[model samples]
Target chain A: MNLTLKVWRQKNSKSAGKLVDYQVSDISPDMSFLEMFDVLNEQLINKGEEPIVFDHDCREGICGMCSMFINGRPHGPKQGITTCQLHMRSFKDGDTIVVEPWRAAAFPVIKDLATDRSSFDRIIASGGFISVNTGNAQDANALPIPKRQADAAFEAAACIACGACVATCKNASAMLFVSAKISQLALLPQGQPERYRRVQSMVAQMDAEGFGNCTNTRACEAECPKGISLENIARMNRDYYAAKFASEEEV
Target chain B: MSSFGKAFSSSIGKKLVVGITGLFLILFLIVHCFINSLIFLNDGGETFNLGAEFMAGNWPIRAGEIVLFLGLIIHIVQTARLTYENRKARPVKYAAYNGSANSKWYSRSMGLLGTLLLIFLIVHLANFWVVSRFTGIPTHDVNNRENLFAVMVETFQNPWIVLLYVLSMVSLCYHLLHGFASAFQTMGWNHKKYAKLIISVGIWYSIIISVLFAAMPIAIYTGLIN
Candidate 1:
């Protein structure tokens, strides 16, 4: 297969970027989107040109290492998968793909197709942890978590922090991402001790990062590789307001 | 920040304000729509006139009008600020994209619909509310009511004015379609089983209320009840 690529090229966040077109031939249908990029980069290197830079680590969808907005949609046209998991087969032989980095005030561009996602990391670090040390791994059954609650927590935990939610959101909000993290812990018995502080801290950090608000458009969930539910957002809102009110009562 | 400070300061906090005020305005719409629907009694505007007279004369209802306008003003102001912030959040533009594919067009165009409604409100208030309340208007001969029903009939007589009212209701429909459930969601008012109910009700409420309001002007202009 052959395809044309219009990829965003930039020297750094300080510099302007533009779409620089390239064409590749003899692409295998089974090749992942990144692998196709690899073939393109190999051609660029052979011609003594700078290879396009993009972020990727696990190459599987789980690591959340890959970040690319392909043809407008985050992660790509095929729903519920990361850019690395996207196969060249999803496109026609002569298809033209437009690739760009996630555009958000919080996530600044590093270079071609890569943006600084440390803003997400900061939000997670704010309070996305359970500091309580459960001394030993008792029998998994010892925790006695209700099956439904445990399952809900697991579902919320599936968020990969890929920033696709922000990329897809009209407001560029990280509410889904933050809410998923909050809900993951907020649902569990183990997460109860610091629940109020956790939500308050994380939400404050999220706001301080310059992320926008959630209007509940659900685009993030639609574009999410993990299929994280918007229920997590509602949970976060419930918890955040609860925390705020509790703080007010204390005063 | 204090709790209220945080509510006013942060993105979600500000959204909470919009949601609260939006829900209040939604309630106001239901009440307003109900009163206007009374015109359909076809009682030669007698029933509608009594309802209007009661609404205008009651001190509690008059006080509610103040609260309703306060909520509406807050909603409009906060939403305008949020829209500005949202626009700035994406300083750079997408070179190629389809916004409608992700969400409904009405959901994305709240600002435009809101502005249209604002203009409609000003014109509406200037046309009837000012005359009925501040300025002396012709009173009903039989019961000495404010004759707001007569005011509405005469006001909607112009085809241009009727057209404007109809257009405003169209904007109202789209606005409420997105606003109803959105307000609850922002305020975290949801349940697993109940959210579906809430959203379905919101859609229907938007359609029904807008249709009812829209019908009033169109009905009055066409001599349907006269």
Candidate 2:
């Protein structure tokens, strides 16, 4: 299938960006979105032009490195799949796909469709962990976690830190991303020790990052490649609210 | 800014302010709708008149009115500021977009809906609240109540005023449709088990409250109710 692409191109963060249109033919329907992009880049390089740059580490979609808003969606038209996982079959011949970077205050453009999502790392650094020094490895069988809670925790843990939630949110909020991290640690026994501080610190850092607030529009959940539930956001709120109001002794 | 200031002054904090004030206004809507619905008794506005008198004269409600006013002021200010901030966050608008595909139109258009409500509130207060409170409404009975019921009967007689009131209720319907559940969601009251419940209940809550308030003017203007 042949397709036309209108992709955002920027020389650098300080440079102005604009949409540059190009065409590619003889594309296979089964080719992945990025692979098709590879074909396009091959064509661009053959013509002695700068190739489009985007982030993609694990082609399997688990690494969360792939971030592209294609045709007004986080990961193209397919649901529950990253850009690397989206196939060209989702489009038709002569289709024009518009590709752009995640538009958020916190996530700035590096060049082309790629953006710097290291702010997500900064939020996780703030306290998205259990700092309790378990002297030795504890037996997994020793701690009894409810099956339901474990499943939910695993679901929340599915978030790949892709920053799609931030990209799709009208306010550019990171509530879903922060909430997933908070819910992941807040749900387990090892995570229980520093649960209050985990929520307090993570939320504090999230605010410090200058990301917008969650308006509860659920676009993040809908566009999420992992299908992460909105429940995590609610859970984060519950934990943060409790942490904020808890007495010194209770905390 | 201090750490607390940073946290409280961020986008999240603004949303929390919107949620808290929004929930307070929702509560006020219920109370106001229920009391206003008393006119449906159709007993020449006796029940509605007495309810209005009590609300006007009672000290607790009189004091509560002050709190309600403050809540409205804060809610409007915070909502406006958040809209501006969120707009600033996305400096480059989407060249090709359909936000409604991802979320409801009402949910996305809260700023527009809220502005309409603000206009309606100004007109609404000018029509009744100012007369009842500051200028003193015309007397009706021997006991000399404010005759707010008579004021309503007189006001809805104007077709333009009734049309505006009806349009305002339409805006109110949408505002509540989004606001009621949004307030709780932002407050972190969402549960997997309860999230759907709150949203569905919010739909009905918005419909009932706005419809009840709307039926009053339509009923009065058409002489269906005195």
Candidate 3:
């Protein structure tokens, strides 16, 4: 297969960036999008040109690092899949693909197509955990969480902190990401002790990090590799409002 | 507000304000659309004009308008504040890509559309209410009643004015299409079983309001309803 790639290129975070075009030939349809990039890079290196930089640690889609906004849609034309999981078969010969970094002020470009997603980390760190020290870990039967709540918590916990939610969001809001974090902790018996504080802290961090407010678009869930539910966002809203009102009553 | 303090204050407060205010606006749209639909009743403008006059002068309607205004303010302010705060949060993006196509175009463009709707509302009120009340136009019909039909017809006759009205109504529909379900979800109404129901309701509500409202001007323009 032959393809024309218009990839976003930036020297650094402080410099302005633009899409640079490159052409590759003899690509196999089975090659993943990242592998195609590897071919492009190999050619660039052989010609003594700077290899296009992108992020992808595990090509298996587990690491949530393979990010690309291929041909206008994120992760190419496939739905509910990661870039690393996307294969060249999804495209045709003589296709001109336009690739760019996620367009959000929150996610500044580091190089070519790589963004600083540490804001997501900060949101997670804010209160996306159960800090109760069980020392060596609790017995499996210690506290019985209802199967429903446990499952819900697990579902919410599936978020891999991929900034896809932000990148896909028009406002670049991280409400889906933040809500998933809050819902994970707010759903479980083990996460109950600090439920209010957990939502409050995580949401606060999300806001402080410049993520936009959730308009309940559910685009994040649609594009999520893990298929995270927007229900998590609703739960987070309920929890956060409950905590706010409860705290106000205490005052 | 300090970063943490500001965020903490806005998180819950902003959602509540936006939700409540959004619901109020939705209610207003429904009522407004219903009243406007009465023009189709073939009463020769008597019933519709009477209703419009009543709405403009009735104490209850006046009070409702005030409440609607307050809701608009809360909705706009909270949206602006939350948007500003969220912009400050991430400051960066994730490494690998594949997440943009999942969302609706309207969902992402709500802020932009909402701002346009706000501008439209100001123009709408100024043209109809202000002219009727203070600008010294013939308010009453042959029966000494406010001839709202004439006002509406005259107002919608200009191609430019009708164009603006159509554009604004389109913006309003887009805003509501995403916003309706969002308000429901924010209140924890996101059961998978009920998700389709909420989405359908959002679509219907948006369609009804936009079509009904925009139809008034088009109807007048085409002489379908005088």
- Name the best candidate (by lDDT): 1
Residue-level lDDT of model 3, residues A1-251, one tens digit each, is 99998888999999878778899999999999999999999999999999988988978877888778776566778877889989999999999888887767667789988988887888778788777655786779988888988898888878777777777765577877788778877777778878878877777777677666666767777867777887878787777767766554211
For this target, which candidate reaches the highest TM-score against the unseen true structure? 1
List, in the given order, the native-contact fraction of each candidate: 0.56, 0.52, 0.54
Angstrom error of the Cα, residue A1, model 3: value is: 2.1
Pairs in steric clash, model 2: none
lDDT of each: 0.88, 0.86, 0.79
DockQ score for model 1: 0.65
Stretches of candidate 2 exceeding 4 Å from the true structure: A132-136, A249-251, B1-7, B139-144
lDDT of 1: 0.88
DockQ winner, 1 or 3: 1
Looking at candidate 3 chain B, the ten consecutive residues that score lowest on lDDT are B90-99
Arrange candidates by DockQ, highest first: which order? 1, 2, 3
Please give, for residues A1-251, the per-residue lDDT of candidate 1 as tens digits.
99999999999999999999999999999999999999999999999999999999999889997998889899888888999999999999999999999999999999988999999999989899999666877677767888899999999999999999999888999999999999999999889987888898899899889888777777887888999988888888888888877554321
Q: List candidate 3 segments past 4 Å from native.
A: A248-251, B1-12, B77-100, B136-143, B153-167, B220-226
How high is the TM-score of chain A in model 3? 0.95
TM per model?
A: 0.96, 0.95, 0.86
Q: If both were scored by TM-score, which would come out higher, candidate 1 or candidate 3?
A: 1
Better model by lDDT, 2 or 3?
Answer: 2
- Model 3 interface RMSD over true interface Cα atoms: 5.0
